[model samples]
Target chain A: MMAVRSTFGRTGNHPDILAGLVFIVVGALGLWAGRDLRVGAAAMMGPGYLPLIISSLIVFIGLIVTIMGLVRDNERLDVIRLRPLLIILVAVAGFAYAAESLGFILAAIWLIGVGSMADRETRLREVAASIVVLTTFGILVFIVGLGVQMKLGPF
Target chain B: MEFLDSLILGFSTAATPTNLLFCLMGALLGTLIGVLPGIGPTATLAILLPITFFLPPLAALIMLAGIFYGAQYGGSTTAILVNLPGEASSVVTAIDGYQMAKQGRAGAALAVAALGSFFAGTVSTLGLAIAGPALATLALSFGPAEYFSLTIFGLLCATVLASGSVIKAIAMICIGLLLGMVGTDVNSGSERLTFGATELFDGVEFVVIAVGLFGIAEIIVNLETPELRGLIAAKISRLWPTRDDFRRAWPAVLRGTGLGTFLGILPGGGATLSAFSAYTLEKKVSRDPRRFGKGAIEGVAGPEAANNAGAQSSFIPLLTLGIPSNAVMAMLLGAMTIHGITPGPAVIQNQPELFWGLVASMWIGNAMLLVINLPLIGLWVRLLTVPYRLLYPAILLFCCVGVYSVSNRAFDVALAVGFGFLGYLFRKAKCEPGPLLLGFVLGPLLETNLRRALLISQGDPSVFIQRPISLALLVAALGLLVLMVVPAVRKTREEAFVDEES
Candidate 1:
């Protein structure tokens, strides 16, 4: 048992600890946000009735998980690579803002162009070609054929 | 006689020109994506959910069903040839299938897998047609108290069957329930957790959550991990399996079909669980278990059949009870809601055409997959060379546009970005997102029924214990909870999942 304990890394169950923290934070947030809503009796449930119960249950589970994490053998978390995560998110967020205002063409180009950069091996020529092709397809299929409400351009 | 007439009506509805065309398109597209690694059927369905709005309800459902079962067939193709299981359900097939390929028996393995899957699909489709009406009729007699207890049972069973820490899965379900309460309450007519967002007054769209979590998060994870591409090393010698191989495969196929059909009906049980269980059963019952993982034909045949059968039968619960068993079924539920078709016991009585039409189309779709997978094997293998760098941009574009199309507003898309980030965090925490989805879909039903039951009983919690069915369901749920606490059962459960990882 001692030998097995040494095999684990310095950090103690990082994944479980992180998971517990997330549950606690989300549960607390739910409680804070819905605090104003009435928690009526079981006979007449208000909007906050189930929400409050579920939120409290979440917090309870979080406490158990956190406690377990402290007692269990140690295990390190996976290395977090922020490059792809951030790049993909920014690309999607940009498209969300651009899709309605700037229209499908620009949004498609921005999405594909910037989205391609999430990978390190992406090339300039491929990105440009994808933007051209995907934009044309989006215009023809989504805009013309499917009758999506978005405009072709900002004009 | 009535069953025959209903089936005939089903065939007539499914055999229509437009439905046939859509069904064929769905099968081909399902095969295309299923053969590709990094894209599963759930994400594919989520991305394409909005596009189906352009199609009629029956046509759309037929196409989606086609994609699902067609994926089972296509997944086995790559598993046999390239040692890469395109779908999670096919992971077990790669064990002996790749070995068969190395022994220059790739064609036999591929043929056996396709044929066995087709057989299993037919049987499960028949099972769905028979069980759907009977189960729906039984459900019609249920009251609010019964439904509340049933939902509790279903939710608890889902956490148990799912591969993870049961407590964590339950917590995720609670989080999902909390998220479901974000919109205006139906009873009180007051916003609960909108946080002053006007767009959220109507509630968060299911498509937004699905696309953000399954679609966007999956891509980011895929990018973070290095790609593993296996080369197809063996030549195809013959397309037909030997008589001895057929004899060995048939009994396994029969056993697999029976097991898959039963498992698929359970909560949180689908192709992945069914296939894993069937493989384990086959290994246990084999006369010489050492042949497994060393070109054993039964190894490929059993799991291939089980996954296909399980995929088809999982639709039974959703079609009959309006309760989705897995994430894919949840997507189907969302699709049904979008088309203004409420899936429940009334669906069979009121919209008989729709229910029967979907059942019949599944059979047609399975037949189409057999034809598509066998002859077009080379085409799908060629597609494996299409690098993720080129593919992901297209997927990212589709996901963005799909979410925007749901409400024709960018707000939903923006909201999905937040979910995408949260989904990434959940992945880092090693939490499975599947239970969260099931919880979100069932939360409203659970709360509504619980409120009604309590209201009728004048706040008496004993109403749950008073009803016979409700008492039985709650007791079963309690039993499952107790079983999970037993140290021996917990160890075996852990061991069962550990087998899949290796």
Candidate 2:
């Protein structure tokens, strides 16, 4: 317990409690979602049956985690960092949206350009160089070599 | 005699120019990604899985297998040079390995790691050749009750070995099982949780989850840390280790190989646990334990050997019983399924060429890695200086293309992006995703076996306890659970992981 406390001692919040609560909420949500499925008997189990059992088990474990959280004062939750997380997510999302309509070259260019923003040291010239190199590689590897039937350019 | 014949046949198959070329490509690619920060084998395999569609099945399987073990070799190189483990299995390598680099013995450390890994890989390959067919015969006798029990044991053991919070690991496994239950029910042919989408009918693609969680989530986590941190740029001294260093490392390498081979054969025991346990064992057995964290060559040799051996031996369960011991094996199993080959006892009988060839290629791949890595160490070090800003975007683009290529569906790409966010959230919540992945891969099999066992027994759950093998497995699982609950043992486990975390 002291080890747990020391590990989480930095933030002074009850991370275990938060983690426990998150698990519980997720479990409950899963159970609620799986409720419509039929829970057949053990002899001939239905698809919903295992979900109901597993989700409840998760909730039980979550309860134990919550109890541990309350009894022990331990490490606090880390402050969430939005910059890197957001930039990466947005970059991937942009590529996903653009790749179909915009073609591989443009989609890849957009990805490198925006993803470079995640690092403060990133320069326009570096991003441009990366874009040129990666797009060509992607074309040769994915299309020419692997024979993936994707558009070569946005024509 | 049969083993020798098959091995010869395997060598013949694997030595073909096409197979050798594929193996080389896989090893090179595996090392490339493994040396790069933020891209592990799991992500690389997932992103590259689509390429298998274009290759012959045997070549594809051989290549994928090469990537799996080759990554272990590269992961150790990074651990030695950069103090950052390229994969989870190399976490302990970073401890003594980085210290060695700092002490200007980086070249020695890298050589020891590669040589140790090579030795382990060769030994494990031999073990696989001898033991794989025997284990497959043993698996031929397993019934549904036994299979279900085996999965239970595997899941429980994984939970026990998981880094933090047993309850959380169990929760993750449950969540994984739930997610796996998505799509139409195979039995009744009715949709279970598809929510009326046609894509949902096929269920979630494993590639999407793999890329999102391992690939995309890693990028986000890495990005949170400072982009330009201090790396211990030790001068590359002589590439070869001294006689004294060799003498010290060989024994640890042999011992670690032995330990790892044994552990790798067990369900839920794989490279990561073997490496950690090997390190602990070395610390215990060493005459001067204090020298361990201060650049002991034994530390690098033992864990590197153990992880590589463990990585190879982990293939045992997958080939013999058609059960994956870890995420990488799970991905391989998925790939095999896509190629219309169901992995199980029948594989030895049905696909001897593929099986023996893959086993033989592993040895060849091991040799290839030893040759490929030592000469390329300087190149990999150069790769380390490539800015994460540029590296990550290329990875992201590849991930996008990879997912898109799977079905020519933008939906899967979108799905990967969504899971990437969830994966980041899970990491923040202090949940380890390993058990979740194991559960996800094994979920359907677990469910199938569970239902089958019950159906056979007419609703009697006692069948699990009635069968001797099943009973034994469950008892062992129960004992493991009890051990986890025992405060003292739990503390020791936590300490072991904590030591690695530092």
Candidate 3:
């Protein structure tokens, strides 16, 4: 495992390689997902015509990009700090689930409270104050003023 | 006489109390975000887009247009005072504007930028008023083949002109086209790529993709980097430029305005590209280029005018031809779709008020920006001191609420989370998300036109080449592709984007 990791790190452009792999996977998935749909001629295109064409083009581009990545000058990927990445997503995901069931107050709190932790410099007092202030502001502006159709509480 | 009558109708419609108030709100909000770094006009517009659904169509457009040009005005404020460009379009403004500030001419730089921008805004708005009907008249004659060819030209030009690796941008556009095909096919009524999710039958909401890619992804990226804050460099002793400064800046402003108006009408050309190009032009044309980085008034004046003109004129393509030039125009197109307005040649003939009202509001918004930016510079400077830690949480709340409010579906918000993660991946891969958006908005239109054209031609592909307009557009797209392959033009393209990368 260690030898494999070192070899991967020493290889050509990591970002391009990753990007190419992603494109190939997504294109293949698109082709697989649309296998059931029909593809008529250009005059009368079936549901899968454009999707299949686009998927094949994507895969073709991905192949070229991957080849270029292998032959081009070496460039390392940027340092991936997963802490903020994961925390922000989790905060947003939590808000999505809680918004309808738990109501705006809890959802807004979950969003701001957890989302604030993504930053290393976040102070507890600052987070607490922001949650209170922003929640009230969101309620007034989004719900009351703009009529965004969100319930204020679980009731 | 007809043009004058239309202008009068526009002024009457835009000068209503409600439209005027929304215009002021947009300009004020625009300047606020423009003064603060880290947030961009695209993300702000995305966040605010859902809220506009509650508004009347003309009022909403008026406000959004205000925010777009108002940002250009406010960005130069921070670029001059603190040596930090609050928006990408103001990067060149900071080079000499900051030097002027350090030389105790901050007030002069600020005044010239605001006045020059106001002038450019007026000219571009007039250009819009004059060019709108003529373009619409020409567009009325287009058939399906012409539409398909135009979309192809627009997409190709967008990829070529956008600052990034062309192949990567093209790949991103393909991904966007695939995503746009996910919902039920209108022709056959069968889902293409829903992955077994039923909520996606109606298709992915534009707001969800926008807020996810621009808003949520932006916040995450901002968190990864440490913040840099610059202190205000000098005191404002004077608020007006001297006679000599005016003499030097007027010609540059005139040149910048002309260039910006023309460039902004092109696919993927807007404030940032226009500003960079204007700066290059000024440097090339100057007798003594050494004075550029050393507090030349023309340096501050030229790009400032160009960016404002570019920001305003970019609306022309969307309004007349129903084709968006960039990401922000894509958002506007999305907004128009939500309002049940199909933006095409018919818009001017059928709903004359909407087009003219928006044009009038842009000029009014520019005048408001001058008043908001000049005397209130100190207030905006103070706003720059607000830290990202305190700011991002509010923005995050807006993102969550904004996504949720779109159709009031938890599923959409959840989908946005997925796009947010994908956006993070794309950023790591050095792929721009802007072209993806442009492709997504145009995909359904492209597909519909292609089918119609082929159906008429009985599967014969020669119809595309047979139509004069369609053939010309395809030839232009092919020419652009060939230019990219040439080593000299490729080198120049790479050099043009170097400032953006840095």
Candidate 4:
């Protein structure tokens, strides 16, 4: 069903192709993972029954989508921008790791400082102000007011 | 007589000073966040949901409800002033609203949007009071078969209506259903997808997924587009709509309210679809269709009213059938569960005060929004001038602290980061997260009920078709699938989303 198979060498890649491939792979993985689970009868469905049905459907849908991409005119895939993507993800992961060890205020300040670097122009003064205000607000609203259990300082 | 008595009881419960304060607080926070670009109602609701855990359930629910409709009202403010749709539902509003701003009618457009939203909010609150209990009564008759069928219809509609390739949307839903099954199987006591991790026992937290997909992914996307956003520099000519503008707006508001109220009650339909459909209807009804997008007062008035009304009435399915029509409603459902309150047909009977109080507070909250939005227009416009560089960092920090505080688990935060990455990938692939969220919420319910229905029929697959209601729902789902696959209808759906995308 590769309608565009003749033109494949000429046309650039389309996002729909990649998306379809992802779905098919994910569906196949899900089916394989649940291979051992019993499907059970209609009157008594096992845990695998719905999963099996859904994964198969997912694969079917994925194939249809892949065909649609082949037959229909599609938008070309945009180059992935890794700079901001990495900065934002790594910054958040850093917070997840640091928030517990360094306490709320330090973790938050560290998060802001690193996250601010993702932007083209970084303003230190604004980042500093945001840190002070957000920390006070977080402490006031979350810690003291809501009584969410978090350490105030590493001290 | 019974309705009036219940109304009186509701007023007494909601009119208390504390609830009024929480309502005001929610409205204020909702407007503030709604005015800010990049943070939509879904993100704001998810970020604020954990905080509701500490408050009394009634007050917590009242505040959350206030935030929802309040955000709808405030979303139009940014759309009109800066040509930025602060929320997805307001995307249609930005079309004509920004044109009005360029024509030096910004004040008129903003005023009309606010007035139309307040009117729609009032009418829909009335609708909730009148129709909510009746729907609950209707839902009381639903068996496991009916529930399974209803969820099937909801998931299918959600997949179809989502703004992307229908196949991709269905795939997302299937993936969501799979992700939702990660925890232990309630009936069999075996984990479905969990790979023997202790954290997998309870399944993944809804908050973790919500924050990651909406909050974190949004920040990542916004980071890539670092262009300076300029505010519309049009002078404030008049602070209110002219007489002629009022004449054009009132009828549109009425039509919008009717459209929104009707669609909002449907399982998969809500504010975003209502706004789009309302704009399309307004264009169809207009004698001069060319004026529809170029600063037509009806364009601003209709979609704003429709969005707010749809937002309010979306609660019908949530409170009555315990089915969330959208992501924000799902978060609210999660909040209610945390408070040990199961929202369903019995909720009205078992928690009358909580039910009626939420209803009463909605009306009060609408009044508060009218007061807060009009006078604070200038302040919000100034908020648009704030640099995104500073603002996004604060948003990310709050997201981190919020997710961590959910269970004080670092593991959850890590999990949230992972979802955020996946969310970004989905966005790149043009797959929508909305159907995924809806499917995830409805997954367990669908599974549990399908099993139960089969159990009752001794595993006969025909059990779903034998019952009238179940059969009707399944037929509707099938019909929707057929409609979605039809070439003409698929083209129209794609065109609608494409118009909004540009």
Which numbered prediction scores highest in DockQ against the true structure? Answer: 3
DockQ score for candidate 3: 0.80
* Model 2 lDDT tens row, B156-189: 8777865788878888888888889889889877
By the TM-score metric, which is better: model 2 or model 4?
Answer: 4
Give the clashing pairs for model 2.
A8-A75
Q: What is the interface RMSD of candidate 1, in Å?
A: 0.8
The model with the greater DockQ, 2 or 4, is 4
Which regions of candidate 1 fall more than 4 Å away from where they truly are?
A1-9, B499-502
What is candidate 3's lDDT per residue for B115-159, written digit by digit as tens? 999999999999999999999999999999999999999999989
Q: Which 10-residue window of candidate 1 chain B scores lowest in summed lDDT?
A: B493-502
Candidates 2 and 3, the one with greater TM-score: 3
User: lDDT tens digits, residues B399-472, model 1?
Assistant: 99899988899999999899999899888788988888889989899999999999999999999999999999
Off by over 4 Å in 4: A1-13, A152-155
Ranking by DockQ: 3, 1, 4, 2
TM-score of the B chain in model 3?
A: 0.99
* lDDT score at residue B294, model 3, on the 0-100 scale: 98
- How many clashes in each structure? 0, 1, 0, 2
Per-residue lDDT of model 3, residues A1-155, tens digit only: 10112147576887788788778887898899898999999989999999999999999988888888888888877767777899999999999999989899999999999999999999999999999999999888888998888777889
